[model samples]
Target: MDIKNIRQEMALLDDVIPLEGHHYAACLQTYEAASSQRKLILEWFTNHVIPQIPRDSASFLSIGCGAGELDVKILAAAKEQASTIAYVGLEPDSKQCERFTASMALPSDQNIRVETLNTNFEKYTEQRRFDRVLMVHSLYYMNDPERAIEKALNLVNESGKLIILIASNDTLNELSSSFWQMENGGSTWFSEDLSKHLDKRGVAFDRHRIKAKLDITSCCAPESEQGIRIADFIAQAPTGELPPGLRTMIFSYLEATSHLDGEMRWLPHNVDAFII
Candidate 1:
């Protein structure tokens, strides 16, 4: 099938498959995994990244910070260090942003000054640059990831860091291989490719790449279980119906994997830490 046909098929699947709750649950599970990863990321930042910074007070901008799992962890760390860190989270999804803000208001020792911006990173502009800018697991949704990276770079101050946590092309290719085979599609976006594209755009940057594996078997329990509650939200068209084959394929895939142990297993997620 042609690329256009593939896109149409995928769109059809998206329409018919009511996977919003599934995705929401999956995101929560992924966030829990990310919470674990956050510890390592924090350690890396504290031992290596933070010391490199020249200032005691740092401003951090996270594009698509999701439910603020990483933000909360980072803010808690800053509290321990007695550092003044300002955090700005940009999330396109209003619901998720609301959840993030609600979660941030919880009692904590972390003197985290958080501001949640309900807007896209590309459309949002800032008068001042940040000490660190990050896009964690959210760049793939962007239509123009290269431009998004440039926009992120523009938000960074001199000697500041641009941190990106993205699934490697290889990892995505592998995970989606079966789905692609079943549906006939190609690969998704990549962090390394984005980095290379950034370099081609005349952006001088460095990279610190790392990989991690997470176990998420507990999250995908039966739908009745409260392990990870995800809403299966499919975008409905005017017809409000999905193609038969597309819907079948998606649900079948979900069913096949629902009971399986979910793990990142060598799924190399590139954490490209760029210094400008």
Candidate 2:
């Protein structure tokens, strides 16, 4: 249960896995469940967050903006109200950046400018701040989450805000705690832990819960390609190269806990959003 050794395990996973498209197919199975629950986060952002930005031209920075899908949605929604937005993305993967740039080319009546920096947030610097800064589901992999949060907060202009989305510690992360803790004595990563660090720093923030779940029945299918990807994602392993015993344990865990909601076999998620 040595905390220092946890990073080594994380690094091993990072070095071994390229996460591109690993969750895409699995996501397709849970689309209905995901869409219904995730809409709340989007609605909150549009109603509460979008109003914070200036109606004129505004700049946005999204760390780990994979393929710019959410950015596009935000931009399109902003357009409905006649706001101009310029997007800057920071993503380490070149292929993802390329996809982000390509997807943003859609013809739109709204004023928009798109740019992607193929770099990690730790090394990125800007002369000026942005109207909005987002770190969605990206902080878990950071070597230093507190520092990353601080850096993102600094990038927000005087009137802008830094928004972060992470999983609540009491929920799914708790279910999958054995793998993440590995030999670590306690939970090291999760929204609850992040909130504590922020609180210790006397940082003021607002919190909201976004209820969501994934139907992973397909993961249990015969030959289970989706199941394999689910395991890879949970383990953060590139090839899902888990020990036979560990794989069996994880599969048993998933099967036992999967909730049946009518026709859906749901794996519930408790996601939280922090606005600072």
Choose the strongest candidate by TM-score. 2
- Model 2 alpha-carbon miss at residue 100, Å: 0.8
Most accurate candidate by lDDT? 2
Global lDDT of each candidate: 0.57, 0.68
Stretches of candidate 1 above 4 Å error? 1-26, 34-36, 80-82, 106-112, 171-187, 216-276
Give the TM-score of each candidate.
Answer: 0.67, 0.82
Model 2: how far is 91 from its true place, Å?
0.2
lDDT score for candidate 2 against the true structure:
0.68
Model 2 spans > 4 angstroms off: 1-38, 108-110, 174-188, 238-240
